[model samples]
Target: MGRNRISGVIPSSLGNLQMLNDIDLSRNALVGSIPTSFANFGYLFSMDLSNNELNGSIPKEILNLPSLSTFFILYNNFLSRPLPQEVRFLEWVGTIDLSGNHLSGNISMSIGMCKSLEKLLKANNMFSGPIPDTLVEVKGLETLDLSSNELSDSIPPEIRNLNAL
Candidate 1:
């Protein structure tokens, strides 16, 4: 269920439903780290856990959801840590929202490998450094939000070549 006032931690048993395709637990009061068992959602295509009380580093295993195409975990409780390099595994993913968290460190250049990626919302975090030149490789990207971070250096000159922006 999504957009409800539901509170408390997500149940790990939800992972047992192999046929489940999407989950939207956004705009809730849910707390605690995401259930690691969610990595078992082989059929899951989308998930939104934004605007919740969830905390802790995202489980890297959850990034392996083979069918996952959209992910949103914005405006959450104190989640922190560098996004895992395995994020490139979301080859089919088109949109991702990880803004307004406590995440720190450099944005992974490998993110440019997500061939289908279009919208990337990573504003309002602690990311620092020049935008990776490799990001220009995401030829289909339409919206990229890196505002409010500590990034420095000149804007990648190649950014002008992204016709999709």
Candidate 2:
């Protein structure tokens, strides 16, 4: 349904599509919460619910997907909250864009565990505190944008050492 102005709630039962490999509901007017049942899609590896009115934190099970490689939910109306801990375990995620939301929390040190992380766009949120030193472990990280936030603490000078690591 190209160019269809989809509105209203996404049917929760759509998550039952077990063999689903990808879902692209972006660039639409879909409202309401993302169905938690979608986590049951074992083959689900890519999802894009961006540019919508979806609120609340992302379902934790979405992160637990062993094959999830790209999780992009940027440009939504979701509120401030910490990223799920299990998300740090994604071994193939090369990029994560949680930008333009109300997300506020300490940047988890566990982000370092996502060794495959390359592009991380977290700008325009209420995220506070200092950057975690462990982020240096993401050797593939090429872009990190955290501008426009209440980040109060000064970035330690030692953070510059990440360039050498």
Candidate 3:
């Protein structure tokens, strides 16, 4: 449903597409939580769930996907706590966009482990705490954004290492 004006929950039944490797539901008017059924998309390698009215927690199971990449969960009304501990492995991912939500709590140090991260856009949220020194561990991090939040701390020395950004 790319660029469709469809609003409301993505049918939980979409999870039944077990062989689907790519799903693009971006730029839609969808709302509510991403169904837990979505974790059933085991073969999904690329998913674009960005630019919607979706809310609720980021499912932990989605992070465990072995071949998944290109996650886009941006520009929505997501009201939730910090992402799960397991999502840190999303470092194996590319182009994750989780901007414009109401998520709070410390930005996980585990995110530093996502060495494959690029196009990382997380701004306009309630995320607080210091920039973790561990963030330097994400080697290919090209776009590190932590803007417009309540984040308070001295900039970590490790950030200086990202001169490439």
lDDT (Cα) of model 3: 0.78
lDDT of 2 by residue, 1-165 (tens): 213689888898888898987788887788777788888878877777777777777677777667767765555566457777776867677778888888888877788888887777788888889887777788777778888877777675655655523
Question: C-alpha displacement of 113 in model 1, angstroms?
Answer: 0.9
Better of 2 and 3 by TM-score: 3
| Candidate 3: residue 65 lDDT (0-100) | 71
TM match of model 1 to true structure? 0.94
What is the Å distance of residue 27 in model 2 from its true position?
1.3
- In Å, residue 82's CA in model 1 sits off its true spot by 0.8
TM-score of 3: 0.91
C-alpha positional error of residue 94 in candidate 3 after TM-score superposition, expressed in Å: 1.4
lDDT tens digits, residue span 1-165, model 3: 779999878898998887889888888888888877777877777877877888888878777776777664555566578877886757668877778888888888888778777767778888899878887877777887889888888998877787556
Clashing pairs in 1: none
Runs with alpha carbons beyond 4 Å of true place in candidate 2: 1-3, 156-165
> What's the TM-score of every candidate structure?
0.94, 0.87, 0.91
| Cα-based RMSD of candidate 3 | 1.5
Worst 10 residues of 3 by lDDT: 70-79
Question: Given candidate 3, what's the lDDT at residue 144?
Answer: 76
